[model samples]
Target: MKTIKNLFTALLLVLFLSAIIIACKKATDDPQPTPTPVTSITSIDPSTAPVGSTIAITGTNFNTNPASNTITIGGVTATIVSATATRLVVVVPTGAANGPVSVTAGGQTAQSAASFTVAIPSVKPVKEVRGTTFANQNWKKDTVYLIRGMVYIPADYTLTIDPGTVIKGAGPELDPTGQNISGTLVIERRGKIIAKGTAAQPIVFTSAKAVGQRAAGDWGGLVLIGKAAINRPASTSFAGGVRGVVETYSEFDDNSGTLQYVRIEFGGTSQPNAPTNKLNGLTLYGVGYNTTIDHVQVSYSSNDAFGWFGGTVNAKNLVAYRGFDDDWSSDWGYVGKVQFGVALRDPAVGNPAGSNGIESQNFDPGENADGPLAKQNGLPQTAPIFANISNFAFSSTPTVGLYQAGIFLSRNTAISLYNSLFYGYPEGLHLDGTATGTLANITSGALDLKGIVLANTLTPVVGTGVITNDLATAYFAGAGRTNLIVQTSDLASLLFNGANFTLTAPNFLPQAGSPLLTGAATGGKVADSFFTSVSYRGAFGTDNWISSWTNFNPQSTDYDR
Candidate 1:
């Protein structure tokens, strides 16, 4: 009886302990916490941008994955560049309307307080423009501008010119007798330009004078100066407090700007009868490799249509039409790359001091041609590579000044011209002056003009002592196969414009049965991905690259207000 009574008391004690433990557990337990969603945009940077431009959007509660986030500009779907919890990068969509920019992420949406403005294509009336320093601003495609003075875009700023934007220079007439005070757009060092125009609507720079009165040197043309490698005289960088003049850049590729599908007409000013103080349709000074310049055309330029001074920029699809001087000039140690270009010369427009499709030299006439030698101070000795070019002297009665040629290489220039065509020039390829160093490169296979075709040239090759016309022709002929000196009639189907070389409606493509169609090499220095390899010896292949985006008729369009 005593054992049973003790067991019952123990059981009751155990039950009471169990009940207290259960109550304590229930009191200590807490509920799971939930986070609130955030849906707000604090701010936006560069609230305005054109189509196909990048813009940064900042806000809260953005998904980490860019694919999970949705962004729209002006109600159009924008391309997401990157995404994070606090920031997002997107490109303004094409054909986007003007409206609020919105973002939707993780089932939450946020709209910016300020609406994004759509860049409208507004046309401007003709008037005078230029002579002021341009700030860092976006020049929209809304209206055309008349540049009357020397307009400067200083460093730390960008001048964004939209496609279809017409900029006319009002110099000479705007400020007559003041040559230095021309309507010019100068991009100083550290400044950048992003003018990517399309073929259908290209960016045009022309004279402000009426069509009937317009002439070359009406005003200064587009000049781009950058901090890139150049072989200038020692210790001559940014001297004289000049804003645009730069000495050199350490890098091969410097990100300065882009100029694509652009046309400059009636530009290039000079003194009464000298090549001094002249400008080009497009001038690149110490430009870097990072710059993108292609699909450009210059017409009626008094000097070189496109000139380069000490830079490593690469260009393609260039057209120099009816220029008075050299179509393409390189000096001051320009070691860039050029391919697929066309130069059509009109006898009515030219000079007597030796005009050529290409004029290459290591330095200016006064500077040391071999000083610092080649590749000194990170500057190559005016060694340029020209491939797949078409140079046509349209004038049947070619009056060459100072021995004109399809190409002129002098002053110790180590050049490579391949897969090209030269027609109607006084001399197909002329190498003048003292160039002992450059000649060695030819024998060493470092400098050469292979697979070239010279049609109707009075003299195919001209060079210094030992490299006379006969020696040049023999050396070039023995160097490789596919080099030819043919008659103009043998080329077949190369139509001409009005009197000569106007090329109003040119068909540069050779006939199917022509030997030039199959004489091109498949591999070479220019056989990279950036360049399209063709089986033809000229600039044109099956592709019509010069169509649509280029402007051949600058005289008909009235760009002034």
Candidate 2:
């Protein structure tokens, strides 16, 4: 009996040991790391969703618990409905125009991944109604719509245009008025226009003509009229131009409309050197405030790329290339500020191919006309005033050299600048006036300048008997880089930042171990925004902003124009 009891106890012990071993094995092989819960957006719904359409987003690793969760595209917020460990759904919001869409979740951001395109319905035409007027009826593209010559905007109508829409100008020999063939877009009073474009599909206001063969001054630039602050002194012709008083009014300057991501090509000519002839890429007369103008480019105009007379308008991201006369010529009296501008000279266009970057001032010298009858009354004079001009680049060669000042500040012209760069010309900086211009005073007035760079190699600025390296560097930093090499990882910002260098893949800033990085004036000045770390020497910053895009190479053999 005693032996039997011992056998039973040993059996029980064995069973208990087997159960413990099984439990230990299960815990060791368990899969409980959780993987950190990663979430990434893969694609968007209705990828071609039109404007006002609700966009649905699909992605992985969505937060099942709806706390501390958010999603955005291009800095614009999106609405999320449902989320899970493997999927997320959201809707695109209004006022979110076309551009890149970046997704952020749990503090993680991914850019340059997917694009959000705004849908634009095809334009259809309506027969002439009571008060509606249409321009360019001759070049109609569809049956319901009028062709290239005429387009009608309803009274008080607001037109929304997507970027990348190439609106061709009227071809030659179509209109009898001669003004018609200038490929014009006229905005009437009391009308609103919104022509916006993005970087990828910028709205191009070009001619239907093929590329490469396109000539300068091919079409009439955009013409907008509004009621705002304008200095209309006496002697400033009203009939030839627009009539307005030199006064500041707080109201929306119709602009007639807004233009963005627009490129006006082959514009600016009054029929071959008539001088007084009227043609330009964009003509703003009596344009008012309350209009948005950004990323507007005017290339190869016969006259001026942008001409403003007797209006208060503000523009940004203006590019003037290879115009015959001036890149930005303001007459009568314009009161506004401009930023982020590039005036590039063309080696093949004008008699010299290069025109001055600016021809700014009131047309009436010494006459401060603020009214249609300013000559009779007398207020502030007729000269236009520029308040702020920051981040601008100018370049000129002997063949395309500007005849006068690179920045011609004519009669009573006032301007302020900050974080800007100017280079590549016969002279680094030029100020032409009867009275000695106030460098200190001008620098203090709304200029807010910090990082400024002035570099040149041609003639007096360099070579023997000219300014030495120390003096030139003191006066104009980075002058004559013909001997130096510029290392750049990105070309988009470099080109867009508004600096001049013949090579597309330019070495503007110091490299990882370059000597120029030690307190060197980047972009001709010492500003923080010009670079990420140890600022680049020119317009673009050497930070990660450039690491994404490919470098541009413009060689003598590779250059077309």
Name the best candidate (by lDDT). Answer: 1
TM for every model, in the order presented, reads 0.72, 0.53
Report the C-alpha lDDT of model 2 over 298-367, residue by residue, as the tens digit.
Answer: 7767788788765656776566666677677776556555655655555344434445555665445444
Clashes of 2: 45
Q: Which ten residues in a row have the lowest lDDT in candidate 1?
A: 236-245
Q: Give the alpha carbon lDDT tens digit for every residue of 116-228 in model 1.
A: 88664334655344554557656655566777556777778888888888888876456533544566677777789888899887888888787778888787788888777
- Against the hidden true structure, what lDDT does model 1 obtain? 0.74
Best by TM-score, which number? 1
Error of 2 at 57 (Å): 31
Please give the lDDT score for candidate 2.
Answer: 0.48
